[model samples]
Structure formats: C-alpha cells, structure tokens
Target: MRRHTIRPLAALAATGALALTGCAADDGTAGEGTSPGDGGRTLHAQRVMQLTQVHPQTGMTLLEGPTFDEEGRLLVVDVTAPAGEPKVIRVDLDEETAQPLHTDDRGAYTSAQFSPYDGRLYLTDFAGGAVVSLAPDGGDPHTFFSGDVDGAPMNPDDLAFDPEGNLYLSDSRGMREGEPLGRVVRIDRDGEEATVLADGLAATNGISFDAGYDGLWISELLENRISYLHLDAEGGVASRHTAVHVDGGIAQTDSIAVDADGNLYQALHGRPAMLVYSPHGEHLATVEIPAGHQGLESATNVAIVPGGTTAYLTVSGPAGGYLYSFEALAEGTRQSNGG
Candidate 1:
C-alpha cells in the first residue's frame, strides 16, 4: 500500500484566491476534543490548507467521490463533459500522478467505495440508475444492483455501507429545483434483498456513519439539511431525525466525512468551505477552500490517508479538479465496512 506525508508548504498561508484565515497551526489546544465522545466545546479545525494541486489549473474533469483502494491509492469518478460519460481515475499519491483506468464502458459514475465484504469498488452509475462493481485495478466492471424495488427507479446517487456489512444508497430523483423526491435504500449483507429505509428526502447526496455506528448521516441537497438515522441491528433505519440544517449559505451540501472523534466534515457544493459539525449535530467550524474548479463552487468528497493523520479531498467541476491533502485537527476512523 502507498503511504503519503503532507508535502511541505512554505507556510500555511492562503495562496492566490483561496483567502484562508483564522486557521493555522495552534498549540493543538484549540481542540479540547474528547475521544469518541458525543459532546464538546465548539471546535475550530486547523485550516485545511492545500497539500498540492493533483491536477492542472485549466482542467476539464469534474470529479466525484473519493475512495481509497486496498493498495492505498485514491480513486475518483469523472462525470466527463459533453456527452456525460463516466470514467475512473486512480491517483498514485507517492508518485503524485493520476492514471485513467481502463473500463469496458463505465457509463455514468457519480460515487464509489471499496467494499469490505468483497474488497471491490462499488460505484453509482447515474445514467443507468444502478450500482456497479469493479476490481481494484479497474478491470471487469459489472452490474452489482439495478432497477426498481418499490415501483420507482432506484436513481442511486451516493452510497455507504455499515458496520454490519449491509449496504445503503441514496435515490435522489435529481438535483432539481422546488421540492424533490428522494429516499435512502438498503441492501442486506447477503446482497439478496433491497429495502427503502426512509423516504421524502430531497436531493439526497451523501451518506455516512458516525465513529461508533450509532447513527447514519445523509445530506439532502435540495432540503439543505443533514439527517441522522438510527439503524436497527440488521442495518435498516429504525428512526430518522435531522442532524444539521443549513438555513442559509451553501445549503447544497454534496458530501460528508466523519473523523474518529465524531466530528463531521461536510462538502458545501455551492461555496468554498468545509462545514464542520459536532457529534450531536451542532455547527462547530468552517475550513475555507482556496478555490474551486474554474470558479465553480463545488467541493465533492473527502477521504483520509491510511495513517489517519491527513485528509484528502476531491474538489472540482467540469472545467477541472484537484486532489488536496491537509493536516487534520483530529484523527479519522477508516471505513470499517469498506476495504
């Protein structure tokens, strides 16, 4: 597996148009953050300064979903422009290079994760309204799940599995205006059954679990809120509740990541910041993004390096994107259900 250290920067100063402030190396005391706790003082994140631009400035690939393969390589989807074709690219951190993987026909990929049960990459094929799997080397792309369960199209967007080896998916009708129809769906660990866990969601974009697996978190884009669902032992939603609601400012949250301390990092797609929340859903901090793809305010997803000390983010638009790594204020819990 590949290992990476944060490439050195002269200082943590904001470069160019990023304009980052109020965050720098502190005494590490700014965070009296507890270990795996459910409460704490409103903590500030150490400014997420860019590690390096893994791509060029005038780029042309809109990036989605960040997943790390078993080899510790970063994988992301390119919702390619013009025809909306989808592709996958593997980024070698040690070499600081990206190589497009050869797939027979990936179609439209929106998000992906490495499954712990099978150790393969599972992805959302948006155009086909299905989920597909691929070998870690990006070979043998095949359909994993597709079609309807309760009459409507699955229209899977983003996905996450649980500690029990069960799978979860978000069926966002579309990221459209006005009230939208969306829901969270689940697949049993045996992959033999499908169930809709919750409904009436709007633009459900991202889903995840807390450090302790106590709650399942989802970002409803059009609804501008992150909902937490209490899951039954088999990984079905027993109860659902709102974790955080964005009343104003960058309400279209596209994705999220949680650290080992239960700190949630949300990707605000319409702005240049990472929204932070406490375990109990209280707003805590904001990490400024220096810039976006060709001025497009879309921060896609975040993943941590194996050592847990750094976080890598995929942020970009059709004009191009960059993989940025930064020192995190807290350590992260690796996906127990995803290899």
Candidate 2:
C-alpha cells in the first residue's frame, strides 16, 4: 500500500472542480470528447460527470474498485497509498456529493462491491490480505476473510458474488516475488472455510460471473488476456479458455465490469484508457481521456452503471485521481455515430 496524509475535503473539492473545468474546455464541448480506437477507429464520450480528486476531505480519490448500490449510488475504494490507511467512499450520483463510508489502518482497500441480496459492502484489502464486510449504513466493518485460508497463503485482490450469495475471490498468490499466480476461492454464506475453485493462473486481478451465472470471466493482468471458465453443476469451473488478448503492451488489467448487453469493459492499469470488448472477445473500441485531462493519470477500475449507459473509472495517482463518467455507446454503434 502507498502512504499519504488525508487532506482537507474543501481543498480536494476545489482541485477536482478546476480539473473538470479544464477538461471540459479542452474538449471544446461541455460534456463530450473523442477517443481513439484500434485499426484507426474512434470513439466519442459524452462526459456525464468528472470527479477530479478523491480524499476524505474531497470525498473521492484514485478509485480502485467501484460498484452501484441498491439505491443506485456509486461505491468505490481508494487505493492511492502504497502503504498505510485507505478509504471506501460512496458517491451520490444525483447529488454529486461524495461521502467517506469506511476507513481502515491495516492497508489500502483495492476493490469493492455492494451485495444486492444482503445490502452489505465487501471490500478487498491488498496489503493486509483480508476481505472486509461493512454494513449498509456505514457501521463497523467485520472481517469476512483473512490471510492464509485453509493453510494456503492468500494475497486477495478482487472479488464478485453470484445470485446464490456465494462470494468468489481472486487471490494473486505470491505476486511480490515476481511469480504471482492466480487462484479463485469460494466462500459460502456460512463462512465455514475457504475453498480453492481454480488455481495456477498468470496473475488474475478481476473476476465476474456472466449474467446467467453459468460462466465466470477473469482478467489475466500479466498475460494481457481474459478467460472464460465454464461452471459445472456444482458451481465449479469445468473448463477454461482464452476469451480476449490485448495487444500493444497494455497488459496490466486491474478490474472489469459487464453491461446488460453483454459488452465487457476493462480498466487498464498504467494505461490512460479503458478497453471495451464484445462478448466474443473481439476488440470493439478504446475509451481515452482528453489529452490535457488532469484526473485520468492511471485508469485502474471500472463499474457499469445500473442502466448501462454510464461507466465510472478510477484514476490512480499521488495527487488523488477522479471517478470519471463516460456514456456507454450502443452495440454496433461506430465512433462516427457520436459513440
């Protein structure tokens, strides 16, 4: 985890507001800009909102993992610090007000999700190797999972839940030593123990179930690819295959979100944009921030809004990044069609 003192909220807000203003000016539009795509394609983004800075004071930061709550509010984790405390924040989309939901001194919170079934927030702690469950009203947080589950060392990174209430966690085992492999662990509602569902992956960072809950999609960050694992009758992986392969040395995928139409969006760490792929793994397009934009230094995580027309991306940086909003384009809609 990275370390930095929390600044005053007012200061952060001012900085973010200024950054958004600058971005809007550079694009020559109040709410839209053009983005580049592969094979000379182009995408257009109509900016719905721009959150420039995230901090306890500013109420947003380089957002790590983001998801929508039952009431449609956006929840995101802050992972700006390489060490020390981190925060989880909730942004009221209608009001545009960000409020700190939870804070932990153990380490940076990397990813987060809101369970519609139970209305609890599940967050992953990277350095601390734990999964925390917070109450919906911002009550005390409790540990859902910790290090060394079932005697196997765990470096828990990201997670997703199925309709049956089973939580699937991604453990990037042994990452710091440069030999990080991937494993998927399933924790039932009873909290009895952790069970490894899949193992020996090349750096898995994100996982999400298909809308039908019959298949799982995982992001292989180091390999710059996505894989689909077919689930068997017991809800375990029966077989797996590569779904997509990203080119151009932009392999550090951090988080992923799926829309109603089955389109997939991936947050590319170290790259300045998000990659969009069709369900068949074809590279559909790329979404980029305007060149002079200040908020998007490193696009890390993304969450599709409930209606599927908006995507919120977390930008990682020292000065704190923003929770940027981009309108989702319709299927088969070319960039020339206002994206």
Candidate 3:
C-alpha cells in the first residue's frame, strides 16, 4: 500500500506557492505541468473547514470526493475514518464548521456526487466495492448498485453523473504494476445494467464529463497520467488518447474537476497543490496552499461551484481533513462537481 506518512510542515512551507510549466510526453504529447517556476498563475487557497477525525492506521485523515449539491452545500467523504466516526460530512464555508452526515462500519467511501435524475447523493464505497446512495439530508443510506461486472469484483474509487442521470464510476481494482487493471464503468440511468466504457487503466482514480458531455476525462493515479475518451451516442468509447501525463515525483494524481471553458483541475494526493490544464492539455495555472497552511499536504480532490469561479479543494494530512477555496480559471458547471 502507498504510504500516508506526514512530513514536516516547516519544510513544505518553505516552498511557498508554485507556478509551473507543462512538459511533453515521450510521444510528443502534452503530459502535465511538472516544471515549476514558469511564471504561471499561482493562487493561494484559504482554509474553509477542518475536520477533527483521525484514522488509527495512518494517524491522519484523508479527504476526497468534493462536490456541491443543488442547494450549494459542500459535501465530502473521509476515506480513512473507520466505523462510528463521521465518514461523510457537510461543511459550512462561512462558519468554518462541519456536521457529520453519515457513517458505516466497513464502508470506505472515496467519492460522493448527487445524481441529476434521482436527486439523491451517491457515494462510491471503495472498500465495499459498491455504490451507495443517500437522501439529500444525508439520511436513509441505501445500496444503489453492487456485484461483479463480467464475473470480476469491483473497487470503485470515484464517480460522476451525466445530465441524463447516467452513472459513471472508476474501478481501481485489478491494478498489477505494468499490467493495468483499472476501468471506467457506466451504469444505466436506472442502475439496471452497466457497460465498461474503457479498460486497461492503471489505478483509475477520477472520472468526469467534458464541457460538451461528449467525452470523459479520466485520471490514472499510478500512471500519473490523464486520458480523454470520446463517447459515442451509446456511451461507449469511440476514441481514447492520452491527455496529460503528470510527473508528480512522490505525489500521485487523485480526483479531478473541470471548468466551464474545459479547463481541468487535477488534484494531487501527496502534494499540497492542484495543477490546472486547458482542454488541449496545456498547463494553465497552479493552485497551492499558502505558507501557513502547507501543513495540509494531501490535496486529493476539488469541486468548482456551478455558475461560479470559486473552487473548493478537499485536503488532508497530519493536521486532518480540510476544505480550501481558490479562484478557478473559468466558470464552473455541473461537470465541476464530483469526480
């Protein structure tokens, strides 16, 4: 398993905020913005909420799956917290407070999004290999979808919904080093069936629809890369190609969110920053935590509020889970929430 050990905050604070430049892949494609100090835009995020929960194994909390509901409430899941602890939480940005909404004895929910068709919050239980649902008020947790796909078990990490309410989730299981085992599965609107849109991925972690909803932007954590999959009318993969290959050093790519103009916000699991890329895979900007807030090193997921430029990031480390806010490169839409 990957290590979650927290490093010294003072050493991380010295780096300050960073501005990066994109690097070219071996195939001459735009990979990611790994070269720092390119004079790009650097925005410092302000902390919004801090969770007090801690995981016994890792000695710190890990947050992911940030999304905003139609009512503009910020929701996130604590992937490291155990049973009896708050596994899911709602944050009050103005008041800087959090409320426990759900908990489970064996569920390790890695992502959460509200379905457009059903108006219910859906969570991807990574540990249970199932998709769970809850009422808007975070009550009545239900098992929305579970079971094997083609005789193979699932390990869902993150999920997103299309305008028509079709569910798409990332299966992170079957990863075997050079032998990729991750896949993107699309469940029908009614949750009666599922189709594998793309497969042979390396630790698929994030999934989001494009601005036009004709394609999907997927992040492969172990590969440190992103891919764009053009979808056909039936939601099958029409064409797929590498998008952004990030060289994160000790960090790995986590959840991602897209802006209205097609800018992708890629979050890093072990780093204290987020890298923004244009639709064409061009590096746009780097959003980072300020010096004093560098203690929160796990910048794992981001959610941009629809119709607004404000972006909220879910970060956690030794200090605990936290929500931070920064300005995005473009306005956000429903695609901006939950990946």
Number of the top-ranking candidate, with TM-score as the measure: 3
Whole-model lDDT, candidate 3? 0.78
What's the lDDT for residue 309 in model 3?
84
RMSD to the true structure for each prediction, in A, is 10.0, 8.1, 9.2
Across 24-76, the per-residue lDDT of candidate 2 in tens digits comes to 22332324333344542334333444444444432335567777766777777
Q: Which 10-residue window of candidate 2 scores lowest in summed lDDT?
A: 330-339
Model 3 lDDT-worst window of ten: 17-26
Model 2: per-residue Cα lDDT at residue 247: 71
Which pairs in model 3 have colliding backbones? 31-245
lDDT of 3 by residue, 290-333 (tens): 66653567788888878988888887877667777788888988
Residue 277 of candidate 3: its Cα lDDT? 89
Ranking by TM-score: 3, 2, 1
Against the correct fold, how does model 1 do in TM-score? 0.77
With candidate 1 superimposed using the best TM-score fit, by how many Å does residue 232's alpha carbon deviate from the native? Answer: 1.3
In angstroms, the error of model 1 at 213 is 1.6
- Could you tell me how far off, in angstroms, the CA of residue 312 lies in candidate 1 after the best superposition? 1.1
Per-model TM-score on C-alpha atoms: 0.77, 0.80, 0.88
